[model samples]
Target: MNNRILVTYASRAGSTAGVAEAIGKTLIGKGLQVDVLPMQDVKDLSPYRAVVAGSAIRGQKWLPEAMQFLSDHRSELSRKPFAAFMVCITLSMTNAGQYLEGLKSWMSPVRDLVHPVSEGYFAGALDFSKLPFSLNVLAMRFVVLIGVWKQGDHRDWSAIHAWAESLPSRLLQ
Candidate 1:
């Protein structure tokens, strides 16, 4: 059967968009027809066999548009093979507990809204330079005090690819 997968995300500074694109590429490589789109552009989910939705977490919550998209399509999503991920600096490669919590929080809404076949948390990048001045100052202080805000890409590409590849297998069953 031909599988149509929709990968949607709400990104603030492109990290989440990158993750969504990577997932779409991986699914395409696996022979699925994938549509990678922003949450605002996805008004319906009836065309897809499976859906992968994600968003960057801000203040420990999904972006409003992403949340609304899920809320609007909850029923359709529940009937399909679904997966989710969250982009957050809280999931830096070195912090296991924070990563777990970020993943849990990211997936919590998905779990409550749909029965996802798989879910993952990928380490997110935080560029202090790209942040607004207020956020940058806070991040700088955070880096200085707690050493949590390193300035570079920390995404785990291998893990993301693996996670994306595994989705089809889980959903096919």
Candidate 2:
């Protein structure tokens, strides 16, 4: 169908998945048919006219599974209208211009395989209980000792909805 789209994401601690669902809902509100699924669960792209892929960032990179999903579906994705989004703690620390410039490095690998018509960057949430104890300890050191991070939901929904509102034009045109 001309209006069909796929919104998929790879999430580590669930923030990215919530973002994907919100995106899918927004697309549906725009009268497009959409499916929001975990990246690993999407086996085919033929049913969708456009694909929106997203991921949670870790260690300055898109999670491995999200990268793998793009690589695995590169052929089909390169032929279709593909867009991407990323959720990261880094966004909370930068200005718009700086964030855009810096995140380019993170997308370099994806850019090599797919050119997204649009890209969305949103702040992500943090929950130590969702992470492994080792990582929890490390993150806590950064949070507690350095006073570098605060643990809480940091996603900007207004920004997210605004970005999603702009996508149909970019994806369906």
Candidate 3:
């Protein structure tokens, strides 16, 4: 039987969706049958042998849709070889270690709920222009004052690819 993997994500302004696509491409490159879909579009997880669920963190929490996806599929997910990933601006290059720690804490609840075989923390993009007006203004000001926020996509594509390529080996064992 062919091994199929579902790659699903929850994105607010498309950055996380880009991450999901990159992951899907990497998995496909490894000869795995993969489906990349949005969390809202995926109603069931029964068709795939493994799953990789990703979310964009907002205010230190998993996006509502993603959290619900996990809660809704907890039982099915528990039976498979699964992985979880989160994308966030907090993971920008300069503060990667700190951001990873925060991501770990934020994911703890869902991690316990799903008990995945592997998990990942990916750096995400921050386009102030795409953010809500109030948030954009605040983020801009914070960047100016703190001197840490650099505009442009900050995702580490290589790291994402490496993680995706390793999943099949991890799950099939």
Candidate 4:
């Protein structure tokens, strides 16, 4: 039997975790065994045949733990099929083309560091209420005062599902 697929993520405020769960569930529906875990919770890559890793973006970079995971498991990961996704509100539906262009630039570190078979870019969810209390209040006030931050769920479920469903064959190819 093929080894299980691992859908691991590094999320702050949980949006990326939700995306990882959706991916894991879609793979399971296709009769693949899957393990969905946080990057911190993953201790072994030996059990997985392929990996789908993602992280929420802050400023313009992936979380430290996600980067560390890739760094720590570089050799093991290089031997298997891998795919990556990034979650950022800036990549909203309205700006998907820029998202594609930005994907290569933003993921340069990953590309330079490790090879992946495919990549995904997704719009992220952001709720000011979920941020730390002081930061939330500050961000809410900033939004009201300057209209810089957009707060809402912008993730496109159908797109995420379609991408997830394509992975098994993608790995094969």
- Relative to the true structure, how large is the alpha-carbon lDDT of every model? 0.80, 0.88, 0.86, 0.86
Tens-digit per-residue lDDT, 57-168, candidate 1: 8767788888888889888888888888888776674756645853585577667877777877877877766766787458556763676566678788888899999988
The residue-level lDDT of candidate 3 at 108 comes to: 88
Over 7-47, each residue of candidate 3 has an lDDT whose tens digit, in order, gives 99999889999999999999999888999999999987878
Residue pairs of candidate 2 with colliding backbone atoms: none
lDDT of 2 by residue, 32-134 (tens): 8999999889999999999999999887789899999999999999999999999987677545457678787888887888999998888998888788778
- Clash counts per candidate, in order, are 0, 0, 0, 0
lDDT per residue for candidate 4 within 1-173, as digits (tens), equals 37689999999899999999999999999998999999999999988889999999875788888999999999989988999999987766564675577566788888777788888888898787688777646755576467554678888999999999999997755
Instruction: Indicate which candidate wins on lDDT.
Output: 2
Off by over 4 Å in 1: 97-103, 133-145
User: TM-scores for all candidates?
Assistant: 0.87, 0.92, 0.90, 0.89
> Which one wins on TM-score?
2
Which residue runs does candidate 4 get wrong by more than 4 Å?
133-145
Error of 2 at 1 (Å): 4.4
